[model samples]
Target: MHLIIMRHGEAGWHTNDQQRELTETGRRDVADVAAHLAESPYRPRAIWCSPLLRAQQTAAIVAEVINCPIEEKSFITPDDDPGLCLDALLEQPPASPLLIVSHMPLVGALATLLVDAHRRGLPFMPGEAVVLDMPVVGPGCADMKTQFLP
Candidate 1:
């Protein structure tokens, strides 16, 4: 299965919680990424996103272009443990092509763990995404075939 992890677009920091909506540049960047993905050879079966405004908006834009369903999962919430979130996602049934829209540390940490089997966290830039091909064995134990960033 392919797991595509995406970081939300740039968000306004005016709000107290950083739940502010995406800025104009954020929208354009997300659109560019989504458009590129839509024209590419890869396509996701489904999209899952955090409920945060930025994440949700980014997911919506991609979903619109990809014509896929978007499911909100609480595990992607900000400040949530990336390991736990990875565990939860791995426990679920595999989707051939899955897209996960989430925040910085979680997405970065999950990618690091999946690639190296170590929990070293890396910071994913805003609107960046990584596509990983994981073995379909048991959950959280898959081998990585390849990874791409955009």
Candidate 2:
């Protein structure tokens, strides 16, 4: 299985973080990432996203570019636990290639958990993505294939 963990694009400062929208630069950055993925071998079967406005927007752009379906997943919210997310994902894995659009530490932690469970997770800036090739959906069962940063 292939997993692509993506951080939402840069967003404006808002009193309500969950409602914050992507900035112009954020939109462009995500679009660039989408274009990059479009040319790559990756063809997403499904995209799971945090329900937060920015993440949902980012997932929409990626899904459109990749010609895949996108859905809001509660476990991917910024504050959710990476381990919980991993468990949920494993319970019902998507197709071979699954994309998750979410926030910083979640994306980074999830990536790390998939590839190297005992180590500290890598950091992900806005509009960054990490690709992993997993033999199975379990801890330390995968390898990082690439990291695409906007």
Count clashes in each candidate, considering only residues at least 3 apart in sequence or on different chains. 0, 0
Instruction: Give one digit per residue, the lDDT tens place, for model 1 in 47-99.
Output: 98998989999999899989999999888876777777666665886466788
Per-prediction TM-score to the true structure, in the order listed: 0.87, 0.95
**Over 4 Å off in model 1, which ranges?**
137-150
Alpha-carbon lDDT, every model: 0.77, 0.86
Weakest 10 consecutive residues of candidate 2 by summed lDDT: 35-44
Candidate 1: give its CA RMSD in angstroms.
Answer: 2.4
lDDT of 2: 0.86
Worst-scoring 10-residue span by lDDT in model 1: 137-146
Cα RMSD of predicted structure 2 = 1.2
Best by lDDT: 2
